[model samples]
Target: MTSISIRSNIQTEIREFLKLAIPLASAQVAQATTGFVDAVMMGWLGQEVLAAGGLATMIFMAMMMTGIGIISGVSPLVAEAYGAKQNRRVGQITRQGLWIALLLAIPGMMIIANLDGLMHQFGQAENIVTLADTYLNVMAWGLFPAIAFAVLRGCIVSLSEARPVMFIVVTATGFNIIGNYVLAFGKLGFPEMGIAGLAVASICAHWIMFLSLLGYMVWHKALRQYSLFKTLHRLEPKTMQQLLWVGGPIGITTLLEYGLFTTLTFFMGALGTPVLAAHQIVLQTLTVIYMVPLAMSYAATVRVGQWFGQRDWQQVRQAAFVSIGLAVMFLIVAAIALFTHSRQIIGLYLNLNDPANANVLNIGVSLMTVAAFGQVLDGVQRTANGVLQGLQDTRIPMLLGTFSYWGVGLTTSYFLGFHTDLAGTGIWLGSYIGIATAAIAFIWRFRGILSKKESRHPINGLTFKE
Candidate 1:
């Protein structure tokens, strides 16, 4: 291809990526915005309330990501099937996904319902443990809808119809925030429910999002042709097994990554409420930044899977590389913005003018600086993993991810946070190495797979088995 033609093709690919990525990112942003709303409202309650709420949120995230990661396998499967014009197979895959979502909800709810003892085991104060337990107890009720929402979302986004997902989620998030303010603050003659009210708002928000997407699937002319709800009770043992095989590693990897943050929260909880509250502020900011690339990765997963399904190896490579490049560039700029706006961003989550918040704000600024310096690699790892998911190449990536996060990141976090004076900041700095390591390993793995394909080599070296 001529240089001009190559540039045009690259530009075309970028536009395609952003078209899918932006809406997915918007949905994620809306979702994370609800977290921001919760954080700010918790801040209004008190430092201890904020601290307990933050811990509860992290644990909920860990549970939620585990289920979502597993269901995410359906996205690539649906993309490949749809791209190959197998509409019936797409329906089957989605049905299996919903079944998996329902099954996951059972154990997940049980765990969330009984976390009070676990909080006590962590040596948290009685009040903090009680508040966190109250939050999780209510949030457990929303877990199934959230998981089902992930399945429906993946199917739609795979079909390149992410706008509805974004619209429904944004609308639901608006409902969630409004509900939070009115119920938590007793704004409408409703008794203030505090943290429990926030959880109730989250529950209603997820149900709204779930039902909206489900309704769209039922009523929308284009999607209705797939008969997604037909045979909803049918069992597809092989398909469910495939999803589990491909997605089990994904769930474990998700657990590992979120598990890191959850553990860090425990460390912060031990340090005191001020440190925990500050950690929540910076972590929430980082989540907003991370959601952009995370959404881009999911978009790349759909695109690359479609290309792979069509047996277009070169297009697959192009789509993935463009996504990685876009994500990294965005995060590099985001890191700069975080560096400059550390105080202002923290101010959004906590009270800056209050003398009571001074220590939390100061800790938050320091943690924000640490995050700003380290988050670029996060983009690289997420997009690279997305490529692997597209190829159904997740098992080895899981191992590499576990080693990087636990072996390198969590280990360093513990030693640096407790064994030295660097404290919480050192813990944050260690994550940079972990993210970079995963980026290098995952990128290396994908490059190897691509090289094998480009060279017309045997498929024996494929990262995962069929």
Candidate 2:
């Protein structure tokens, strides 16, 4: 343990963590940039469009994350298999992951098809509801492709070959932008569809990204040896159960967190259009910065899983610590930047000079400060969860997430935003409270697990179980 904690060993682990995380982060950033582009374009269509598009996107993402989160079960499973040199198990897990993605799509598409009713129930305006519904209908076509891509991505990251994933997403980002432009303006002989065009562009991006990665995984000489295409038609029941058992909780956990954010839209919608728009812009900024830590969390899952699979408890703990530390440090800098550039950052989403945009811009700038502070805690919790997932201990964290994000966090936001002077800021503050609690609980859980495992297994005689 002392040797593993020394400066050189720690530095090596840090390097390994970054090696996996940076490209993964870049891929995440590219995907997020697609949404940022959507937000920027929505801004071009005016405040109503921005607000409506933001609302629609929030709903779409909540659905997408729910499915993808379940499919993400492949990540840690593949990592453990790869670590233990179980090539056949890796292939089986990856294939079953794809199956889970396909199955989840049925429900996801149904949810998309019914969003109008949901939006109406939330009491959204007629025009806003109409616009959001139209956007979601087109975006629904991308659901399976998007979820399938998640499975492919999980497999690749666990293989410790993430550069190709970044490549695919960066390419998709370009395609999305160009497609949005051509279809939105009726360029390249396409009929102008405006908002629907953006939705179409996004669908194209998802399908292309998924297909391209699938082709790479199948055809690439190095990767193809595993025969990922070997069992395409057969469904293994046990494999499916493994994926669902692990992934269902992950999916629900993701939904709990994402749904919390989604619920805030209703609160802002109740407050008025300006508040909603402001919240959306602030959300965009938060999403962009979040990719780094999100990537770190993913990297942590892989690195920690590898060590755990090898039964190297010391390295497992070291990997977990370094990943969390790096994410926190990076986000601290991001927080400082967010605080300093609040006005400038808000300007990217709305025109600060335009008197018409003043209210939304001011609200956004204020929320940016809160998001900046919250970002650090968010980094901690997310990366900590990654560590737990790597160790294949997800169910308890799921329970904790339910309590933290909903029981404590959501309850706090409801009171602060509706019953106090905080309003939008209160909502943001409340979400962070939930995030902070998750971070603390998750870290504590990690330490306790390590201590318990150490007592029972000792340093030299250790075996990890999922």
Candidate 3:
């Protein structure tokens, strides 16, 4: 092709990626706002409460990602089926996904409810453990609803109907804020429940998001034709197996990444309350910014899945490259902002002037400074993982993630934090290496996949065979 043609194609690809990515990214930010809302509101309660809440939130997210990984199978399946014009198959996959969500929730609730023993085993302080236990016990009930919402979201997002999800998420953010205020502080005729109240608000928000999205899917003109609700009670072994095949690795991958951070939380907790609190603040801030690349990855999965379904290898590669480029560019900007204004950002989460909070504030600023270097790599790895998911190639990525995060990241963190004087800073530095390793591996894997000849046969009803 001529230079003009190549330039035009690049522009078109960028536009396509942005069209899907922008709304999805906004929705992700809105979803992340729940955590931000909890962190900030809990911060108002006190650093101890904030630390406990943050620890509980990280554990909750770790479990939540498991169910999310399982249900994520819906995206590529629905996207490919939709692209292939197999409307009935799309509906079947979604219905089965709900079953998977419900099944996962049972054990999830149990695990969360019984986290008290586990936290103690990890050497967490009794006070923080008590508060975290209270938080998890109440928040556990929300797991099923949250997983259900994720399933529906996967279907909607794969079909490229992300705006409604964004709308509901924005609405839920408002409800969460109101609910947190009234319940956590004894306003609106409710008893003040402290950290537990925050958990309750999160549960309420999850249910609202689930119900709203379900209602929209039922009523939406374009979506009604798929009849996602028609076979909700039925279970297909083949469909379930397919979902597991794709989703199990995704779950493992999520665990690999989340487990690393969760383990770091434990390490921070071991250091003391101030260090733990600082870690939470920096983590929450980075998570919010991380949503941009996360959303782009989701978009990549949808776009690549659809293009693969249509046997358009060129467009699939185009979508992958474009997504990676956008993720890198966005994260570069975020890294700059974080690096330049570390104290300013931490100040938003803590009262820097308060003597009690000074240590937490200083530690948080330092962590954020270290975090700035990793943001770009984090984006790249997350985007590459998303593209691979779209291509329906997950097992290798899972292996890579395991090695990078656990073998390289955690081992380094332990040696640095415990065996050396770097302490929390050492842990953060180790995370940088782990994430960069995963990013490099994923990008290499994706490029290799793109360079190979395209096969005509479909892989798992989603991707083309290698």
Highest TM-score model number: 2
What is the model-wide C-alpha lDDT for candidate 3? Answer: 0.89
Residue 210: error of model 1 in Å?
Answer: 0.5
lDDT of each: 0.90, 0.89, 0.89
Q: Per-residue lDDT tens digits of candidate 3, residues 398-444?
A: 99999999999999988888888888888999988999999999988
- Tens-place lDDT digits, model 2, residues 1-466: 3765687889999988889999999999989998998998888888988898999999999999999888778889889889988888888988888888888898889888788887878878888898898899999999999999999999988999999999999999999989988887689899988889999999999999999999999888888757787978899999889888878888999999899999988888888899999999989878988999999999999998888778787788999999999998999999999999899877887778899999998788788889988989999999999999998888889999999999989999989999999999998899889989999999999999877776777665355452
Output the lDDT of residue 389, model 3.
94
**lDDT tens per residue, model 1, 1-466:** 8999888988988898899999999999999999989998998898888999999999999999999998889989999888788899888999999999999999999998898888888878899999999999999999999999999999999999999999998999999999999988888899999999999999999999999999999899999777788999998999999899888899999999999889888988888888888999888888878899999999999999987777677678899899999998999999999999999988877678989889888888889888886888888899999989998888999999999999999888888888999888888878778878999999999999877776773333233323
C-alpha lDDT (0 to 100) for residue 253 of candidate 2: 95
**Shift of residue 101 alpha carbon in model 1, Å:** 0.2
> What is the lDDT, from 0 to 100, of the residue 342 in candidate 3?
92
Better of 1 and 2 by lDDT: 1
Q: Residue 322 of candidate 2: its Cα lDDT?
A: 97
> What are the models' TM-scores?
0.97, 0.97, 0.97
Q: How high a TM-score does candidate 3 get?
A: 0.97
